[model samples]
Target: MKLNMVLDNKKTILVLALVLLSFIGIGSLLPEELTLQRWVAAFFAANALVAMALTFVLSTRLEILETIFRGLDRVYKAHRWAGMWSVFSIFMHWWLVPQSETPRDESSLMEIGSDTGEWATWLLLALVVISFMRILPYHLWRWSHRLMGLVFFVSVFHYLFAVRPFQLFSPAGIAMNVTAIVGLAAWWYYAFGKSTSKHHLAKVQNVKKENGVVSFEAKPLQGRPTWNAGQFAFISVLHHEKIAKEPHPFTIASSQHQGVARFSVAGLGDYTKTLYDHLSNGDMVRLDMPYGRFKLNRSSSPQIWMGSGIGITPFVAWLQELNYTGALTSKSCPNVVLYYLVKNAEAAIFAEELQQLTENLPSVTLKIVYSEEGRITPERIADDLNGNVDNAELYFCGNPEVRKAMQEGLESLGMPKNNTHYELFDFRGAI
Candidate 1:
C-alpha cells in the first residue's frame, strides 16, 4: 500500500500531536536526577491525556470528522486504537513516574484531583475491557461504554489541578487544556445536545427472509436522507424489546434515488439472528445513515470488485445506481467485473438480481465463485484481465483474512497498491 494510504489523516494528526507533546513534556519536566526516566514518564502522562481527549472527539461521529477520516468506519477504528493507547499510556505513566517518600502540603482541589485520577484510571480500564467483551449484549455494552466520557471529564479535571511540571500558562499546558476542553465539548454534544439528530423515523416494509439473508425496505416517515450507493446506515428496531435497540450498520442495497432505504442482512451473530427472527413489516425503526466511503471509483480504468458472502450488499447498490442513472447503457461506461464469493449457490443472496443487472449492462460482468469449486485467485483475475492487472483498480469487502491474501497476491501480480480500495467492516470497538 501507498505510504499516504497507510498513514491516514487521523493517524497523521495524532502522531504529530504526540511528537510535539513529547518535545514539550521532556523539555519542561526536567528533573535534577534521573532526568531521562522522569522526562519519559511525563511524556507518557501527556500522551495519555491527549489520547483520551482524542478518544472523546472521535466518538462524537461528527460529519466533518467522517470526511477527514474518509469514513465513519475509519474514525471509529482510530477511536478504538486511541483508547487502547491511552490505557496503555496511563499504566506506563503510573509505573515510571517517581513517587515521593515524604508528604507535601497540598490544597483540597489537588487532593480531590489526585483521588479522582485514581478512580478514572480504574474506570477507564473497566470500560476498555467491556469494549473488548464481544459476548456482551449490545445494549449493556453501549451503556457501559458511555461512562468513558465521564472518565474523560474527570481526567481533564485531574490534568488541571493535579501537580504537574508546568504552569497552566505554559505552551504544553495550554495545548493540552484546549484539546481536552474540545473533547469534553464533543462528548457533551454526543451525549446530550445531538443524540438523535441524525436519526430518520422510518417504518419497515417488504420484509423477507431467504436463505439466511433478511432483506427489507424502510420508508422514511419524514424526509429521506441522501447518500451514495455503496454507503451504509445504522438501524435500530424502536418498538422491539427482544431485539437490542443499539443501531447496527448494514450496507444500503438500493440506489440513491430510491426514496426508501433497503438492507440485506445476514445472520452473522446472535443479535442479527434474533433481529432476523423478530423484525417485521410496519415495524418502526430509527435509521442513522450515510456512513461508509465504499462508493465506486469513476475512473476510466477497468475495475475488479470482490465481495465475499454478505459483502456483496454494496455491489447490489452500485448496480441499482448504474441502472437507475442509465450509466450502464452509456458509451463512457468502463469495463467492470464483479466477483461474488459465497459458500455455494444457495448462500449467494441476490445472485439472480446481480446476474440480471450484469446482463443488461454489457460493460459489467458478474462472476460467482462457490466455495465447493474454489476461491477467486489472483491468477484467475489476471487471466480474466488478459494479463492487464496493472490498469485495473481493485475493490474488496469481506473476510479480513481473505482481503489480506488477495491484496498481497494482487500486488505480486503488478497491481499498484494505491489502485486498490476497501473499508474495514468492523465497528465493534467504538467508544
Candidate 2:
C-alpha cells in the first residue's frame, strides 16, 4: 500500500530519491575506518542525519513544497515517517556501532558537545514517541513536542565538535550542517514566523451550537483571504480559553465569497470544547489562511465523496461554493454522489442544508448513510453508485482509521488505490 501511494504520487517519488542519493553522497565523503562495524555505524549516522533534515523539508509550509507533496496531508505523512526513520536509525547507530570512548585529554567543549548529543538523542526519541502516541493529552503532546528544536540544535553541535578532524571538513559534515541549519530554520518558522505572516485578522460574527458542534461565523477583519472550496486554516482566537491560543486547523465550511467563513468546531478535544465555552460573536481571531490540497474542481471524473461526523465540513464548502463558482452547471463538474455517514438522522447535522444545496444541482446527490440502520459497506457504496466505481475518483475527509478500512474495502472490490484521495484532519499533523 505504501509503495503504491509513493508510486502514484510523483512528488513523493522524487523526494524519496533525493533522500537516498543524499545519504549515499554524504557517506562517500567519510574516510574508510577499515572496520566493517565502523562502516555500518557511519552509514546509519548519515541516514539519521539525512532523515531528520528531510523531516524539516517536509514540515515547512511553502507553496512549491505543498505542490510537490500534492498537499499538506501528504507532507505531514512524509514528515511523520521521516521522523520515525531518523529515530530508528539513531537507535541502530547507538546499539550496533557504539560511539568511540572519549580520550582522557578531551577538551571540556568536546565533552559538553558529546553529552549534549546523548541528551538530544534521548529527547528526540521521547518526542517522537509522544507524537505517534495520540493517547497522550494533546496539551502534553504539543508542548513536549516543541523541545525537538533543542534536540536538533544539540545534535548539530555534537557533530561539529565530536567528529574527527578529517571528517569535520568533509562533504558529509557540510551536508549535515546544511541540513541542521535548515531544520533549525524550519523550527523557527513554525514557532514564530507562520503566526505573524499570512494571518488574516478576523472577528467572530456569530456562533451556533448544533448536534454537539459549535459553528462559528467569522468575518475577516482585513481584506478577506481568497480561498478555494476545500482548504483549511489554522485559527487562533485572542483572549481565548485553555489551548485556544494554539491554532487548530479547521476546514472552511462556507463559500469564500460569502464574506464570512464557517468553521464547525466539534467537541472532540480540550481546545474544541473550550472553543464552545468561550467563543463569542465579537471575539477577535487570527487565521493563517488557505492550506491543504483536498480540492475537487480539477477532476471531472465521476467523483465519490465520503464524510462522517465533522468530516462533512469540506464537502459542505464544496456544495456551497459550487453555485457561485459556476461548478453547479459546468461541464467539467463530475457526477458526484456524497455519502455522509453518521449514527442516526439526528446526527446528520447538515441534512436540511444539504437538501437545500442539492435541490438545484441535478449532477450532485447526497446520501445520508445512517449506521443505525446499517453501517456503510464497500458493497453498499458500489451498489449506490450503480457499479460505476471503476476509474471514478473517490475523495474522503475523515478519521484515519475509517479511511483505512474504507480504502481497503474499496480496493478489495476492484477500486484502484490511486483513485482515492483524503485529507487527514488530525491537527497534530500541522507541524
Candidate 3:
C-alpha cells in the first residue's frame, strides 16, 4: 500500500524475475535463426539504455535534485562506474548481435556514429574525459564539467529517437523510454525552469572573525525554511557580480533561535578568499534552501563526529542544534563525541565556544588533534575510541583522503558499516 512497501527488496526481486521472463518470451517470438545469445545481448542492451541514463544522472548528482542544484558537493565514485557499465552494455549489444539474421534497420554499428546517435556518443565521450581528467587545471575542469547537463539532454534524445526497439520490438521499451523522458523532464523543470527570476537572500547582518575563520550572519528576505542539523545552504551576496548567482554550500553555524543564519567560512580559493576582505553588513544576498542527508536526525544511535579542517561545518551545525534544543545539557541526550583534526591551534575555529559547550555537556566530548604538531595514525582513532566504537555511530565530514582513512580506521576498529556516514565537500575524484 505504501510506496516503500511496494518498492521493497522482494518487489525488486519480483520485477527482475518478470524482466527475465519477458526476455525469454521475446526470444521465443523471434525467428529460430536468432540464437539465444543474441536475444540476451539485445535484452541487456535495452536494459542498459535506462541504466546508463540513470548512471549519468546519478554521477552528475541529478537524482538528488535539491542537493546538487543547491550546490551540495557529495557525489560518489560509484556514480561514474555505473555510467561506464551503461556504455559497456550499449557496446555489447552492438557487438553480440547475430550478423546474418540481424534486422536491416537496427543491426548496423555505423548507426551509432550517425546523426541520431552522434550527440549521445559525443556527450558520453565528453563526460568520460571530464570525469577522468582530474590532473587538468581546476578552472578547465570546472568549465568542462558544466557541459555534463548538455550531454545528459543529448543522451536522452538519443535514447528516444535513435533506439527504435521501443516501436519495433517491445512494449516494455516504450514504457522505459516514457519513464526516462518523464523523469528527466521533471528534474529539468525543478532545477531550472520553475524559478520566478527573483532571489531570496535578505541581508548580511554581521561579520565576525574568530580563530582565523570569518563568520557571516544573514537574515532571509523571504522567511527561512525549517532546516535539520548538519544541513547546508547555498549562499550568494548581492551586487558582487563575480560571485552572484554562483551558490556555494556553507554549513549553518548559528543557533536557529537567533532568527538569523550564520556561515563560518575559511578563506579558500577564488570565492571564499574575499569573505572578510570585501563582505559588509546590510548587504542583501540570495540563500538557497538547505540540502544534505548528513544529519543526526537520520540515525538514532549515539554519534562519533569526525571533523578535519573546515569540514567541521556540519558538526558545528549539529552542536548548534543541540545547544538550541537544550539537549547539550540534558543527561538523557545521546553521547556525541567530536574528534576535530586541525593543522594547529590557530586554525581551530570557535575554540572558546566549543570548549564552553564541551564543559557544559557531560554527554559531549571534544578531542582536538593537531596533525602538524602530532601524528594522527589509525591507531590514534582506536586509542581515542577507548573500547566503545563498535557500538557508536560514525559521521565524518572532511577531505576525501581523510574521510577514506577514517572510514578504514573505524571499520578496522569493528565499527558497523551501516553506522558510518560521511559528507564530501568537493567531489573532484568522484564521478
Candidate 4:
C-alpha cells in the first residue's frame, strides 16, 4: 500500500484512540481499588460502551467525515467492525459481570437499573445476531435496527444506578451517560427525521432508455452543490411511496458544468425495476448533496481507469470534465488505459459514448471486453500497462468480489496496493 493510504487510515485510528483513552481515564478516577474481577469487568464494559457509541456517531451521514475516511464505504467498514466489537464485548460483560458484582445495599431503584441493564444487554446481543445471521427481510432488519435507541434509553438508567465507577456520576459515569444520550438522539434523528426540504428538490426533465439501463436527467428545484466528476447523490422519488422514503445512491454521470444531473439505472433490483414504467418526465424527486472522494487521481499518477457494468458511470463523468489533451487532474496527463467490461453487446449500455470519448481524446485508449471474452485478470492489466505497473495508480469500480480479486492480482503484479482506489456502489450490505 502507498504511504498515503496508510496515513489516510490513521485519522480514523486517532479518533478511536482518543475515545478509548477517555474511557480508561474515567474508569481510573474511581477511588476504590479494583479487584482482578472488577478490573476485567471495567475493561470489557468500557470497550462495549465505546464501540456502541462509535456505531451511532459514524451513522450521522455527514459528508465531511466521508471525505475524512476517503469514502462512505470505509466509514461503513468501520461501523461494521465497531458493531462486531460491541457484540463481543457485550457478550463478555454478560458472562463476567455477575461474578464481579459485589453485594450492595438493597434499593428498589438500583434493582430496577440492574435488571434493565442485564436485559438490555441481551437485547443488544440478539440484534447483532439477527444482523449477522440475516434471519429477517431487509426492510424488517432496518426497522429492528432502530430498536437500539429504545434499548439505549433503558440502559442509560443502568449506567447511572448499577454500573460501577459509572454509578458514582464520576468522569467515566458522566461520559457513559453522555455517550448513551447522544447515541439515542442520533438514532432518533436518523430513523425518524423526515425533513427533506434541505435536500435539493429535483424534477425529472427526461428519461432515456437503452438496453437494460435507463438514463435520467433532472434540474434541481433549488441551487445544488457544485460537485466534481466521480461523485454521487442520494435519490428518492416521492411518488414511489413504498420505497421513496428510502434514498438510493447513484453515481452522477454528467459533468459538473452541465445544467442538469444525470444517472444511469440498471434494472437489477426491486426498486430499480419499477423505474422503467414509473419514472417519467416532470416527476418529483429529492437529491442529497454529492458525496465521494474518487476524483481525477490528483495525488497519484493514475495510468489505468477500469470499470465494469454500471461502475463505468464515474469514469464517464470524469471524461466529460477533461480538456482537449484528456487532461483532468492537477498534474500533467498520463496515458490512461480504459477498460469497460460487460456481459454482452446489450450490456454495453454506454458503448457509443465511450467510443466517441476515446476517439476524441488522444491520450486515452478504450478497450471493451464482453464477459465471455475473458475475465480481466491481473496479467491483462500488467500487460496493458506496458512496464508502467510500478507507479501506475488504478481507479476501479465493480462488484466487490471482482474488486477483491483485481486488487490481490494487482499487488502480486507489482502495482502498489494503495494505488487501487474505488467507491462502493454495493447496497446489499446497507441497512
Candidate 5:
C-alpha cells in the first residue's frame, strides 16, 4: 500500500502510539532524582495547547486557513497524545518526588488543589469528554467548546507558577510558554478577529435548480475578493448569525462572471437543509473568502476530474472559468475528462451545462457513474483505464472513504501519487 494510504487509515492511531513509546523511552532513561512524570506533564500541557488551536481552525471552514491548519492538526494530534502521556508522567513525577525533597519554593500539593487548578482540571476534562463524545448536542457542545481556550490559558499559567523548572531560569520552558501564547493569539485572530463582514457577505441574486442541486448566484459585498474555479467558499445565511459564522465550505458552482460569483450547494447537512428551505433570491448572506489549491490551469497534463455527489461543484466552476477566459473557445485548455459519480440521474445538477461545455470544448470528455443504478468496482475502473490512466492527473472531492478507495484503486492501476489530488470537506476537532 502507498504511504498516503497508510496515512489515510492510521494517521491518528499512529501518532498516539508513537507518543506513548517516546514517553516510555524517556521515562526509563531518566534518573531517579529527575522523575519522568514532570517532563510528561509539561509535554501534555503543550499538546493541549495545540489541540485547542486545531479546534479553532476546524470551526472556521476556511479552505486557505485549513491548508495551513492541517499542518497544525498534525502537530496538535501528536501533542494531544504526548500530552496524555505527559499527564501519566507528571502523576509518576508527583509520586516519585518525595514531599521532603521537594524544594521549599515549589508549589505544594495544596496549591494544586486551589481554585486555579480546580478550574483548569474541570475545563480540560470537559474538552476530553466533548472530543470523544461528538454525538453530544451541537449547541451544548459548542457552548462548552469555548472553554478550551480558558483551559489552555490556565494550564500554561499552572505550568509556569506551579512547576519549579519552568521558572525564569529555564530558557527552554520560557520559550515554550511564549510560543504557546503566540500560537494561541494567532489562531484566535485567524479564527475570529481577522474575519470581517465586508469580505464575507455575498448577496444572493438568483437561485436555480437544474437537476436536484440548487445553484445560488452570488455577488460578494464591497471589498470581497474574486475567486478562481476549483476554489470553494464557506457560506451561511444571515438569520442564524452564530451558525452563519460557522460557514460550511461549498464549491463555487457558477463560473466567475464580470460582477458575481456562484455556488452550488446540495442539501446535505442541517445548515444546508435550512438554506434550501428558507433562502431566496435577493437575500444577502455571509460568505468567507474563496480558498482551495485545486485548479486545472496549473497542470499541463491530461486531467481526470472525479467527483462524487455534490463534489462535482468544483469541476463545474472549472469549466465555467475556462469558458469565461476564452480558453475553451481558443482550444488552449488541456484535454479533460470528468468522471462524475452520483446516486441517480436526478442528482446530476448542471447536466445540460456539462454537456454544453464538453461540446464547446473539444478537448473535454464527460463520464457519469450512478452507484444506485450499478456499482463502480475497482476492476471496472481498471478496465475503463486502458492505456490513458498512466498520464492522467486525477482530482477528487468527496467523502474520505470514497476518496481513499478511488485513490488506492487508481494507484493500483499505475497512476502516480503526485498526479492525484483530493479535497477534505468535513471539518473535525473541538470547533
Candidate 6:
C-alpha cells in the first residue's frame, strides 16, 4: 500500500495504540506471580472492551469524527474493523482465561458480572456472525444489528462489577469508564437522535426514469442541508407504511447552490429495485444529508477524473458547482479531463447534459469511454495526458476493482500515488 493509503487508515492505528496502552496500564496492577496465560487473557479482555467502545463511537456519525477520520465512509470502515477485533478479542479472552471450579469469596456483584460476561459473549458472537452472513435479508440483518447496543451495555456492566485487578482511578479503569460512557452516549444518539434530529423531510419532484436509472429532485420541507460537490446522502421514501424505514446512501447529483438535492438511483439490489418501482412525484422522503469527502483538491496541476457506472453522479455535481460558481471563467483554473466509463452509449446517464456542461466550461474536456470498444487503462490515460502524467492529479469514483487496477497501473507508470484520490463506494461493512 502507498503511504497515503496507510495515512487514510490512521484511525485504525490510533485504536491499536490505545489497545496497547490500555493493556500495559492494566498489566501494571496485576500480581507479578500470575501466569503468562492469565496476563495475556487479561490483555485480550481489555482489548475487547476498548474496541467495543470505539465501535459504538464510530457509529454515532458525529461531525468531529468525520473530520478526524477524513470522511464518514472511512469512519464506517474503521467501525467495521473495530467490531471485528472486539469479537476476536472476546474469543481469545474466553479461551485463555480458565473458569474457576470451586466456590470462592466472590461478592454478589462479581458473580452477576461473571454471568453477564458469559451471556454477552454468546450474544456478541452470534450477532457478529449474523452481520457477516450476506444471505440474511437486509431488513432482518439491520433489525438484528440494533441489539448490539444492548450487548455493549451488558459488556460494560460486566467490566465494571467484575473482579478486576485495576482500581477505578487507575489508567486502565479510567479509560474503560470514559470509553464506556462515551460509547453508550453515542449509541443513544445513533439509535434515537439520528432519526429525529439528523434527518429532514423532503418532497420529491421531477421524477424521471431513463437508461435504467431513476433521477429525482428533493425539495426540503424546511431548511436545506448544506453540502459540497461530490458528497452523498442517505434517503428513505415514505411509502405505504410497509416499506422499511432504513435509508440508502446515494450520491448527490446536483450542486449545493441548487438549494434542492438530487439523486440518480440504479436498481442494483432488492431494496433499490423496490424503491425504483414505488418512488413517485410528491412523495415524502427523509434525507440524511452531506456525507463524504470526495471534493476537488486545491491544486493547480492538471486533473484527470474518471467516473464509472453510477459513479458519474459525483462528477456531475462537481460540474454543476463549477457552473454555478463561474469557476470555468477563471484563468487560474486547472485544466480538467473527465472520462465517463460505461459499457455502451446507452449506459451513459446524463450524456447530453454532461456534453453541454463541458462545452460551456472551457477548462473541462469530456471523453466518453465505452467498455464494449476499449478499456480506460493507465496507458490510455497517459496518452490522453500527452505523456504529461508527472504533474497531473487523478480522481476516480467507481467500481472498487477498477480503482485497484488503475492505482497499481498508475504507480507502475511512474505516477505519484498521492496524486490520486478516490471515494470507496462499498459500505457493506457499515449499517
User: What TM-score would every model get versus the actual structure?
Assistant: 0.89, 0.89, 0.74, 0.88, 0.76, 0.90
Candidate models: Cα lDDT each: 0.80, 0.76, 0.62, 0.75, 0.61, 0.80
lDDT of 6 by residue, 85-161 (tens): 89998889878877888796555888898778888899998898888876578767777778888888898888888
> What pairs collide in candidate 6?
none
Model 1 residue runs over 4 Å out of place are 1-39, 104-107, 133-135, 195-197, 327-331, 429-431
lDDT of 2 by residue, 117-139 (tens): 67777888778877877667766
User: Mind giving the per-residue lDDT tens digits that candidate 3 earns over 117-151?
Assistant: 44555566766666686755555665565565465
Per-residue lDDT of 179 in model 2? 77
Which 10-residue window in model 2 sums to the lowest lDDT? 325-334
RMSD of each: 3.4, 3.3, 6.0, 3.3, 5.8, 3.1
Clashing pairs in 2: none
Global lDDT for candidate 4?
A: 0.75
Q: Over the full model, what C-alpha lDDT does candidate 1 score relative to the true structure?
A: 0.80
Please report, as a residue range, the 10-residue window in candidate 4 with the lowest summed lDDT.
323-332
Candidate 4 per-residue C-alpha lDDT over 193-245 given as tens digits, one digit per residue, 9 for 90 to 100: 73454478888877988776889996887776567888888888887644445
**Which ranges of candidate 2 are over 4 A from the true structure?**
1-8, 96-103, 134-136, 165-167, 241-243, 298-300, 327-331, 427-431
Q: Which scores better on TM-score, 5 or 6?
A: 6
How many residue-pair clashes does candidate 2 contain? 0
How far off is residue 225 in model 4, in Å? 3.0
